[model samples]
Target: MKKITLVFLLIILATTSAQALSWAYPFVVWSGNVYEVTTEEVKNSVISKRIGEVKTKPNDTTGNYYGNASNEYPKGTQYFAISDISTDTAIAVRVKKEKYVKAVFVHKASSHWNPYYYFILFVVAVVLFSLLGKKRFH
Candidate 1:
């Protein structure tokens, strides 16, 4: 039973961590402001420039963009942003540590997760086992 429960938890964490982040490779997006950060930390980001709307030819596909960064990135640039950033449109940033292109689903809002849901499920499991009784009924 303990092994089953442990496995279940590992599976949940694995899936959530995997699905939550599309790419964990170290990358940087500076509002172009100077800042210091580690792979997990971001700071001192500045808005370099917001993409302005322009006339597009037919079959043009684009979204609201507000920032820019070189895909290859220049030296002395931060690798990842520790500060929160939002834009009307999501822009793809370059990851220096990674080989291919990747994206992060930046939310303009916060997220909510119910902790009680897990507690309730745990209670249900306990109740079911108690009702079933121990083997040999001892």
Candidate 2:
């Protein structure tokens, strides 16, 4: 029983490590709208008018923000207009919580493209091929 418990614990640890290594898309929901977050270099002149200030709540998770579904922004995040363009579709922003001044782009959500579906399909295909190949040979 002790050996069985040790094996179970090891399996759990392995699975948790694997999950930690997986990457997720960056997203944030604000003002009843969802935006995908990305970064790019923009001239200080292009980062125009002050739009809004980031009011990140205590419950907001800023560290692992990739899969965060909350509407709260990260602490110290401030948004600015992109030249003359500032709309629901696109905007220029800055995240000040990091070590350096980080410029970010907030774009409207496109579609739900969960990559895990493809991984699951590949695993199924491999299993089916192996099973069918073995049967044909026997």
Q: Model 1, 1-138: lDDT tens per residue? A: 999999999998888432222332333233422121123322224323323221111111221122332223443332232224443223323234332122243333222223456799999999889877875487
Can you tell me which runs of candidate 2 are displaced by over 4 Å? 1-23, 57-73, 96-138
Q: Which pairs in model 2 have colliding backbones?
A: none
Per-model TM-score, in order, reads 0.19, 0.40
lDDT of each: 0.35, 0.52
The count of backbone overlaps in candidate 2 is: 0
lDDT of 2: 0.52
Decoy 1 TM-score against native: 0.19
- Minimum summed lDDT over a 10-residue window in model 1 is located at 54-63
